[model samples]
Target chain A: MEDPKSLSNEESLRIITQMIQTAKGNLKGSSFYFLLWGWVGTLGNLGHFLLIQFSDIEYPSAIWLITVPAWIISLLYGYRQSAKEKVRTYSDTLIAWLWMGFSVCAVILIFSGRFNELIPATILMIAGLATFMTGLILKYKPLVYGGSSFWIFSAMALHVEPVYGLLISAVAIVVGYLIPGYILRSTI
Target chain B: MIPDFKDLDPLLHSQLRLAIMSLLISVQSAEFVFIKEKTGATAGNLSVQIDKLMNAEYIEVTKSFKGKKPVTTCKITKKGIKAFEDYVNTLQGYIKK
Candidate 1:
């Protein structure tokens, strides 16, 4: 094994070059995660709007109003994090808060019967799958596998039992949001 | 016998140059601003270090326009990469207990 510290000028230069290349790879990996989550959040918001418009259920637009801001905040935070500062730690914290807030809102929606619409269910499943795939492509274990579980559960919930929707939502938030958020916080 | 550390080329072995090289190695390519930000070096210092690397043919620098902004990108040469690996291996011999 080569000694890094005592490298000659020529040798040290080579190592430095490798370090830069690795940093770039890391940046790409992290950026993919940020974009994937951002898209998931946006799709979730859109799903809510569609549910309100199509379903006869008496759901207030107020929940969407609240959730929209969270998604927006998360999206902006993700963008800022990708912009070269590597604010992964701060963005991860923000994502956790956003998801926790989302989870609470989802629970309330489910209990209120607002989430009974097929549109919301479909949206959740699609968003989950997309996130899962994004994670897989980047080999981001937290996102790839976690997102896959979220989507797989959502898909199953749609067919097997509707009540499982709530559980699926919870899993989505926990894995897709909370866990990755915390990991990003600690690792990045 | 291995060359003395002090005898190493100052252009390639300087602290700033080493930092720049390390960062370059990790990324596909990095911009001047990115390097400056990561290395915490002033523009003048980074420019000088980059110049040294370029002179030594250890790194390649390209200038381009990103939208309205002019961007400078740098990449490490294959020779530079091998040299770094060897240097690290050699250094380990001295430091390992």
Candidate 2:
């Protein structure tokens, strides 16, 4: 709108309504890292499982190293997103720190030297918590339900064979990450 | 025009400043570009009005770098919110009449 010396009350009210709506609309265009993390997570787990089950790769688990770059990408993406956003909501800050904590926890568990099913179980549990919290913050039902399903998959991971643990992770990532991710993408 | 509406905050009486304040009040803080985009104001024009609001202590302006690009963001202050609320209340009174 052009700058005007004087405006009627109705004109002033209209401008306020329009601008507030434009600000609110800006919050809806983000589903970037959800899709990123989901794809990387699902593919990484599947790759790990296939090598362990069908091939004699000396270190099938080494496939997880592929995610190392995803971490860098995630960080850089988050940094860029932060820079690009003109507004900062409370939920934005909370969700960013929440995933950050989840990343730290995952990193610690991966390096904890506990080569057992419990590692996957605990990791899934932590992942579930982060997903659930993010869903709550965003008020998205698909993610909320998907996050809840992670708990079920985590339990199943405990009873499966060690090689199947990789498969279970793949499934958990699919249900808990990819499904909600697709829905979020569609909504955006 | 009416006597009742005349009591509205003069700082927020103009269209662009009111729009800027409305946007800032909706979100915690907003950048200069975002404000300009939302309000449909020219950069120079928006900057002058923003400076008016800033000088009145109605909003806070922060200048920082988004990567190599310079960015300016603004947030409505407590005084600004009170003024906006008062303006709306006065307008409501005028309308109800």
Candidate 3:
């Protein structure tokens, strides 16, 4: 870049637009986290369904213990990715906190045992809001659509059997995380 | 009427510096290497320009060690934000003219 005073308006405007584009381009190749969660959630939900259907387990819902590994993996993965990041955008921080807040809410709901029946609707609503906000921040349309799908599923989960709600949640994960995650990865 | 280019902040008017500010504005902070890569500016030149911005109180530059290697990070200061916004508005005025 030359002296700002010497450059014409056209050149300055071009540089600004170009630099913004460069920043956005750098955000690619970061979908691995999404895919990780997507797969883990899918497995957790399906596992719960199977556990309940096949066996008379004393506590079939205990199958959710699968998420412990997901949490550990997410922590490690987040640290690794942070190490690689050259710039941490405001949107990145916002997205991270959004998910973290979601996690906190989930823990509170599950542990309190007060709204166990409403867990599916509550979780799906939170997921929808987080995904939608993330999509808006990143300007990613697929994720926005995915979030909408989650909202729709959340509504449906209320009417269906609680067991089936797990399946619906899994489907939501596939749409919200897997498909868009892969797309984001492929584009990078 | 001629465009009121005088409203532009001289500090933010340069090609490289403006680009750097533009990048920094969108993020919390960025590594020196990342700025270099994005601007395609030689490190020596970027460092010099960064120092100028720092001296002007337009940006904050922090030096720290990431493991064994020294890392430099740059963040836009509040002054820098004001200057950049003013600069953009000035540029818009020029465009409108």
Candidate 4:
């Protein structure tokens, strides 16, 4: 076998170009997943709005109903993608399980009438911690930093009035989801 | 007074090696294929460069099976990371006038 490291600069450059081409090809093949995620988010948001505004439902109650099916769908999507991506790491599986746990907690807290005041705050805190842990486990900087920010904001929001809680959630969605999603799309 | 390049040259200071070092600095571990794709190096070339780094004690390599296929993962050692930073600092000295 030829000494792989003994290539001239030009030969190395040629191989590097081929590697990049292969990566781009893989990205192109997976582009549909991006589109699917976008559609899922759009539908989730629409469902949220309908449940809150038109159905005469309480906000937390609305979230409970709306997020359950959304959570299921998203989990299914995640599982399928993880399998396809050959995510064999234990850390990846742990993150997936954590996400599912957060979703279940969110639904349960939303519907618990006796714990109405505490559940939202608890859910926010749990979600933030889960996101942060996911980011750390995956070693993805954006998620790590973004998730920590969410955790901080949610912790702070827990002390404030309900109205301010909504704003915190908005910021979490914007920074943690929207901004990062756009960045991912642009970079990859 | 600055020490000359002859006094302390980076052991794996080529462009591809530098690129590999930079990428490895950020992640816990990366697969050989990932590094090859990221650095745009051929498998053979990447394998060779990786071996050099491993020999220099800058990186640790693990060969494992991913289902039926063989996968090699590489991670920069603490010593390797410190060397990379030192190299960067030394390179900066030249341009800092």
Best-fitting candidate, measured by TM-score?
Answer: 3
Best by lDDT: 3
lDDT of 4: 0.60
Across A32-137, the per-residue lDDT of candidate 3 in tens digits comes to 7778878887888788778888989888878778788878988998897887788988888888899899999888988998987578677888988988888888
- Which digits, one per residue and each the tens of the lDDT, describe model 4 over residues B1-97? 4446432244544667766666676555678877876777788877877888899899999988766888788888999988877765655564463
lDDT on C-alpha atoms for all candidate structures: 0.59, 0.81, 0.85, 0.60
TM-score of each: 0.50, 0.79, 0.92, 0.52
Better of 2 and 4 by TM-score: 2
lDDT by residue (tens digit), candidate 1, B11-96 = 45566777877676555466788777777878987887788788878898898775576778788888777765665565555455
**Candidate 2's residue-wise lDDT over B7-54, tens digit each?**
878889988889889888888788898888877888999999999999
TM-score-based ranking:
3, 2, 4, 1
TM-score pick, better of 2 and 3: 3
Choose 1 or 2, whichever is better by TM-score. Answer: 2
Worst 10 residues of 3 chain B by lDDT: B1-10
Docking class of 3: medium
Ordered by DockQ, highest first, the candidates read: 3, 2, 1, 4
Candidate No. with top DockQ: 3
TM for candidate 2 is 0.79
lDDT of 3 by residue, B1-97 (tens): 4554365677787888999999998888999999999898898889889999999999999998877889899999999998888888889987888
Question: Interface RMSD, all models, one decimal each?
Answer: 9.2, 2.8, 2.4, 7.2
**Model 2, span A39-134: residue lDDT tens:** 887887788788878999898778778788888987888777776787876677778789889989987887888744467678888889988888
Candidate 1's residue-wise lDDT over A1-188, tens digit each? 11124545455545565555445434133544444454454455445445655676676334445555656765686566545433123234444454455556556755676555543456566556655655554457887766676666667657754434544554565667567655765775
Candidates in descending lDDT order: 3, 2, 4, 1
